[model samples]
Target chain A: MSPARLFQGGLVVVAAALAVYPFFGTGYGVRALLQLFMWIALAGSWNLISGLTGYVSFGHVAFFGAGAYTAAILITNAGWSWPLACAAAGVAACGLALLIGYPCLRLKGPYFAIAMLGLNEVLRALVSYFEGLTGGGSGLSLPTLQASVPIYYVMGLCAAAVTALTYVIITSRFGLRLMTIREDEVAAEAMGIDTARHKLYAFLLSAVGPGIVGGLAARDQGYIEPISVFPLATTITMIVMVLFGGKGTVWGPVLGAVILFVSQEVVWARFPYVHQLLFGAIIVAVVLLMPRGVLGILQIKYRLPRTV
Target chain B: MNVVITPAMIAQVVISGLLSGTLYAMVALGLALIFGVMRVINIAHGPMLMLGAYVTFFLYSAFGVNPYLTLPASMAVLFVLGMLLERTLVFRVVDAPELSSLLLTFGISIALVNLAQLAFTSDLRAVEFLTGSFVIGPVAVSKPRIVAFAFAAIITAAAFLFLRNTKLGKAIRATSQSRDVAMVCGINVGRIHLITFGFAAALAAAGGTLIAVIVAIQPEMGQIWTFKSFLVIVLGGAGNYPGALVGGMLLGLIEQLASLFLTTQLSEAVAYVLLVLVLLIRPTGILGGRST
Candidate 1:
C-alpha cells in the first residue's frame, strides 16, 4: 500500500476505535480514554518541537499550567463558558510561549532545556507564592457534574484534529526546513533558512494542542492546583511517551501515549514500586536499544522508508 | 549612616558557604569530569547523587552502620552502578546525536527520581553526625559542618592529585583533549570513558553522603542540586576544575549573602540571575581558560 493510503487508513481505524471505545469500556473506561486522548495530544504536541526541531523543552509544564490556570480562573472568577474559557486558556498559553521562547530560544542544546526548567519552576513558585490569586497550595476546586462525557468526546476530537494538523505540517515544506534544521542548524542557516523564526514557529505550534488539552483536563477534574497543574511528571511522561512511541513520526506519540498510560495504570495498580522501577528501566532500555523509539525500531526492522 | 555587617556574621556566612560550596564543587566536579572527557552531559548525575544518599541512608538507618563508614561502601556501589549504566545505556548513544544522549540521560534521571520517590516515601532523612558548635574567634560553626567541609576539601584534593599525577589520569586527560588522537596513540578511549564516568559517580556519591549528613535527604533533593551544579559548571566553564571550585564558592557566597537580605526563596532565583549575567558577559566563565 502507498504510504499516504496507509496513513489515512490507520487514522480512520483509530478514529473508529476511539468512537466505539466509550461504549464498550463503560464510564470508567471512557474517563481513561479521555485521559489517553489528552496525553496523546500533549505528547504529540511536545514531539512537534522537541522531537522534530531537536529542541528539548524541560518546561512544557509551564504552558500546560498556564492553560489550566487561565481556564480555571476564567470559569471560576469571570463565570465564562467552558469553550470560551478553553480558547482563552489556549491563547494565554500561546502568549506565555512567546514570552519564554523569545529570549531563551536563542540558546541551543541543553541551554534551552535548562531555561525551560527554570521557567517552569518560576511559574510554579510564583503561582504558589501568590496565595490570594492562585489559592496558594490549597488549590482551587470547580463545580463537579456529569457533563464530562461530552467533554471527553470533545477532547478526543481536538486530539484528532491536532494530530492531523501535525501530520500536514510534517509533510509540508515547513517540516522539510525543520528537519534540515534539526539535522544541522549551521548547515540550514548556511542554506538561508531563518533558524530563529522556524524554531519560534515550531515552539508556538507545539504549545497550542497541549494548552487546549490542559484546559480540558482542568475542566474534567473540576479542580486545579499549582502542584497538580504544573506537575513535572506530566512533562516527563509526555516526553517519554513521544520518544518511546517513536519521535518525529505522526502516529508514534499517539501509540506511545496509549501504551505507556495503559501499562502505567496496570503497573501502578499491581506493584507501585516495581512500576516506577520498570518505568525507569524502560527508559534506560529504550535509550539503549531503540534511541529512535518504537517506530524507529519498526522502520529499521521492516526497512521502511522515512515518512512524516 | 553606618550599617555595620559584623565580622562574626560575615565569618559565619563565609564558613557555611565554603562548606556548602565545597560539596557543590565535588558534585559538579564529577559532572565536569564526565562532560570534559566524554562530552556527555549526565543528567543522571543528580539522580546518582540521590541514589548515593539513599544507599547511605538505608545502610545507616536500617543496619545501624555509621554514615561515615557507609560512605565508602555507597561510593563503591555507585561506582559500579555508574559503570553498568554507561556500559549498558549510555554507550549505545555515544555516537548518536547530541539530543539522543541528552534525552536518554534525561529519561534515566526522571525514572530514577520517580523510582526513588516510590521506594522511599517523600520524607526527609538525615544522619546527625556532630551537632555541637565550636567557636572560631567571634564566629561559631557547627562541628559536623566543619567536618563535612574538611571531608570535601580532602576529596577534592585527592581527586586533583589523582587526575594530575596518576598514569590513568593522564590517559583520561589525553583522551578528553582529542578522542581520535587518543585512539591513534593506543589509548583505550572506551576504558577511559568508563573510568571517567565511574569516577564522576563516585564523586557524586561522596557529595550525596556528605549532604545527607549536613541536610535533609529526600528523593527530589537532587533536582535542586542538579540545576545548581549546572550553574556551577557553566560558571566554571565545562572541563575547568579550578573554575568549578571558584564558581561553586562564589555561588555559595552569593546565595548566603542574598538570603540574609532577601527571602530564601529568592536566593535560587538569584543564582539563575547570576548565571544569566555570566552567560551574557563571559560565556567561558571567569576563570575558564582555553584548556577546556
Candidate 2:
C-alpha cells in the first residue's frame, strides 16, 4: 500500500482499538467513552456545515432532538425494531432538516444563527405542545434491559463512518466548493459555484450523522425528554468542541470531543463549581488566545501548513 | 366553561405587556447602542445582564440591600466590565470577519453563563420589591410592576438625553455616524467606543436588576432576553433609542395579547415569528435607518 494509505490504515487500527476501550476499561470509563463517541459524532457533523461552510448553525440540537423523539415515539407506539426505528428516525430528521434549512439558509451570517436558535425553541415548544405524542416535559421511556452493547457498537460505527465521510468530502471537489463559499459567498457564486445547492447538500448530509447518533442515544439511555434530548447545552458543547479543535479540519473536532469530554468528567466530579467556571473560562480564553484550537496550535508547532 | 373577556382584562394585559416590553426595550437599548456605535453585535449583552442580576441578587441576599438601589451599583460595575471587554476582547476582533465577532461574542456568552451557573447554581431567585397595588379606575395594577415600568421609562429617557446632550454622547453619535469622519474631526474614536460599550452594559445592568424584581432570575434567563432584545432591536431599528422604546412596547403587547388567546408555551414564539416577518419584509426594521 502507498504510504498515505498505510498511515490511514494504521490510524483506523488505533481508532478501532480506542472504540473497543469500554470492553477493557472500567464501567465509568465505558460510560465516558460512550459519551465521547456521541459528542464526537455531534462535533464532526457540526463541523461539516459550521466549520467547513462557515454557516454557524446554532440549532443542530433540533435535528438531534427530532431523531431521538422520532425513534422513541416510533419504538413505543409502533413496536418497531431498534434498527428500523433508528433508520426511520434518521430519515425523519433529514426531512425536517431539509424543511428548516431551505428557507432559513437564504439568510447569511448572524442572521442565520439567530434564525436557527429561534427554530430550535420553536421545535421545542411544538414538541412540548404535542403532549399526547411526545409525553411533553415528563419524557418517554424505552424498553428495559434491551442491549447497551449493541448501542455502544453502533455509536462506535457511527462515529467512524461520520469521520470517514467528513474526510472523503473534505478531499473531494465539493469540499473545495464549500471552502470557496465560506471564504466569500459572492465570490464563489461569481465563479459559478451554486452556493445554495452546495450548502443544502452539506446541511442535509450533516443532519444524517447527528440523527443516527441521536437514535443510538435514545436506545442507550432508554429515556428521552425534550430538555435532555434538545438541550441548548448540546449545541454549546458541540460548538465548543469544534471550535476548540479547529473548525474546518476533520480530526480537530474529534480531538476536541475526546479532550473536552474527558476534562468535563474529571472536573465535574471534583469541585463542580470550579469546573463550571473553568468551562466558561476555557471557551473565552481559547477563542481569544487560540482561535484555531489545540490542533491549530499543534499544526503551528509542527509547521504544518493549513489546508484552506 | 365560557370565560368572559372584559375590558379590565384587556387593560391589564396591555399594561403588563407594555411594562414587560419596556424592560425588553431597556435591554435592547443597550444592544442597539453598542451596535450603533461600534457595529458589533454584543452577543454577551445577555450574560452581562445576567451578571447584573446575580450581582443584585447577592447584594440583596448578603447585605439586605434593596434590589432597586443595586441598579446603579450594578450598572457601574457592568460598565467597567464592558469597557474591559471592549478594550481587550472585542477590540481585537473589530476588524475580523463578521463570523469571527459572532463566534467571539458567543464564546464570551458561554463563558459568562457557565461561570454564573457555577457560582450561583441553577436555582431561580427573585427580588421582592413593592407588593402593593395601584388603583386605576376599576383596574388595579401591582405597584412593583408599575414602578418597574416607570423605572424603565425614566432610564430610557435619561439614556436618550445623555446620548443627545452630553459631549461624550455627541462624540459617540459622531462615531456612530462615521468613524473615519469622527476621527478626522479629532474625536477619540477609541474612547468613544469604550464609553459607548460601558454605557450599553450599564443600561443592561439597570434593566437586569428591574427584570429580576419583575420576574425570576436564573443563569439562562439572559438567553431568552437576549433573543427578545434582538427582536426589539430589529423591530425598533438597531441604533435608534426611540425605536427601541416603540418596538419593545409593541412586542410586549403582541406577546401578552397572544398569550391570552394561545398557550403561554407559544407566547415566546410570537416574538420570533414577528422578528422573522420584520426581517423578511423590512430588514431595516420598524424604526428603520439603522445599519445592521
Q: Docking quality tier of candidate 1?
A: acceptable
* Predicted candidate 2 versus true structure: per-residue lDDT over B118-203, tens digit per residue: 77988999887668788888777787788788888899888888878988778888898889999999999988888988888998
lDDT over C-alpha atoms for residue B119 of model 2: 75
Instruction: Identify the leading candidate in terms of DockQ.
Output: 2
DockQ of each: 0.37, 0.44
What lDDT is reached at residue B205 by model 1? 91
Q: What tens-digit string does per-residue lDDT give for candidate 1 at A3-98?
A: 769967987897888787766678888888898888888998998898888888877878889898888888888888888888888888888888
How high is the CA lDDT of each candidate model?
Answer: 0.81, 0.82
lDDT score, candidate 1: 0.81
Give candidate 2 misplaced runs (Cα > 4 Å).
Answer: A1-3, A15-31, A119-121, A192-197, A266-268, A300-308, B1-6, B62-64, B239-241, B289-292
Q: Model 1, which residues run further than 4 Å from truth?
A: A1-26, A117-119, A143-146, A265-268, A299-305, B1-12, B62-66, B114-123, B135-140, B272-282, B288-292
Worst 10 residues of 1 chain B by lDDT: B259-268
> Worst ten-residue run, lDDT, model 2 chain B?
B283-292
